[model samples]
Target: MAKEIERKFLVSGQRWRTFADEGIAIRQAYIVAQDDRSLRVRIYGNGQARITLKVGHTALVRDEYEFEIDRDEAEDMLRHAIGNVIRKVRYKVPHEGHIWEVDVYEGVHRGLVIAEVELASIHDEPELPNWVGREVTGESQYSNQSMALGISEGARLHQLA
Candidate 1:
C-alpha cells in the first residue's frame, strides 16, 4: 500500500512567508477521494492524485497526508474540506537533510498557514526552514484536510469540502 506520513503545525505569524524559498501556482486535478467520510481520493497538478484513508486519531499524529485532487471532483472525494481553495502558498524548507513543504493557504484558509516535512521513515529528522516555527506535526488541528472542513477539537469552521 502507498502511505504518506508527515507532520502538521499551526502558523504562528508571518515569519514563514519571509523564510519561504519558492511558491507554486496550481489548479484542481479532477478526482475524488472521499467516500465514507473516512477515505478520500485526491488529484493534483495535471494528473497527480492519491487515495487516503483516515488512519487513527489524526490529531495526535505528527505525520499527515495531503492528497492532490481535482477542483470539481473534490466535492465527492473529500467531505470535510472547507471552501474552494485551489491555490496554495507552497514553500520549500529544508529539515534535517530533507525538504519540508510549508503551505500558506489562500482564499478561506488565507489566515492559516502550516509547515510539513515528509520523510521516508518516521524517525528521520530533516533540515528545517528558517521560518519554520514550533512543530505541530502530530496535531490534527493543523491538518489541511481538517482545516478545510473545520472538524478539529472545537474549531467551528465553515465546511465547503
Candidate 2:
C-alpha cells in the first residue's frame, strides 16, 4: 500500500519564491468526501489527469491509491463532484534535502498559501524553511476537503487572515 506522510504549514513570507520552480496549475474536485476516506480527481496544466483514493483518519499518514485517467473523464467527474472544484498553482521548493510543495490557492480561496512536505516515514522530520509560518498539520479546517465543501466559510476565514 502507498502511504502518504506529510506535514503542512502556512506560508509566512515571500522567501520561498526564491527557491520555487515554475508552478503548475492544478484543478481538483472530490467525488466522495467522507470523514475517513475520499476520492478525488485532479487535472494538471500539462493536460494529464489522475484519480486518487485516500483512506485513513490520521493527518500525517493515509493509504493512497492513484490512477491515471483521461482528462475528459476527469472533467466529467469534476462536474459531479461533491463540492466546489479547487484551483491552485503548485510549486516545488527544495530545502535541506527535502522537497516542499507550496500551493497557492486561486479563485474563492485566494491569498491562502500552504506548504507541505512529504516524508518517507512518519518518524522523519524535515527541516522547515524560514518562510514557513505556523504548523497546521492536524487541522481539519485547513484541509482541502473542508475548504472545498465549505467554500464560503473558508474564503471568509482566509480573507480575515
Candidate 3:
C-alpha cells in the first residue's frame, strides 16, 4: 500500500503556466465515494487508465492502492459511476524542489483550478508558488469526490473563491 500525502491549494494567477508542462487530459469518476473510503477509475489522455482504492479518515494522508486497468473496462466503469464524471487537464509545474500538479477543472466544475503537491512524509514542507492562492488542504468541500457528488456546490465554491 502507498500512503498518499499531499496538500491542496487554489490557483491564483496565470504565472504558474510558464513552468508547467503541456497538460494531460483526464477523466475520472468514483465507483464508490464515502467520507473515509473511495473507489475511483481514471482514464488519462487517450491511452492510459487506472483504478484506485483509497481508505483513510485523515485529510492529509490515505492508504492508496492503484492498478492499471484496460481502457475499455475503465470506460465501462465510468458509465456506471455514482456521480458526475470529472473532466480536467492536469499540468505538472516544477517549483522549488517539488512538482505541483495543477488541475484545471472542466465540464460541470469549470473555472476551478487546484494545485496539489505530494509529500514523501508528513513533515516535508513543499514551498508554495506565488501563483497559489488559499490552501484548501483539509477542506472536504474542495475534494474531488465531494465535487463530483455535489456539482452545484463545486460551482458555488469556485465563484466564492
Question: For candidate 2, what is the TM-score?
Answer: 0.94
- For candidate 1, lDDT tens digit of each residue in 73-97? 6545444443333456577765457
Query: What are the TM-scores, per candidate, against the unseen true structure?
Result: 0.58, 0.94, 0.95
Error of 1 at 130 (Å): 2.9
Q: lDDT scores for all predictions?
A: 0.52, 0.89, 0.90
lDDT tens digits, residue span 40-153, model 3: 999999689999999999879999999999999999999999989999999999999999999999987888899999999999988889999888888887888988887447
**Which stretches in model 2 have alpha-carbon errors above 4 Å?**
151-161
Which stretches of candidate 1 lie above 4 Å from their native place? 11-22, 26-37, 41-87, 152-161
Candidate 3, residue 148: CA error in Å? Answer: 0.9
Candidate 3 has its poorest 10 consecutive residues by lDDT at 152-161
RMSD of 3: 1.6
Extract clashing residue pairs from model 3.
none
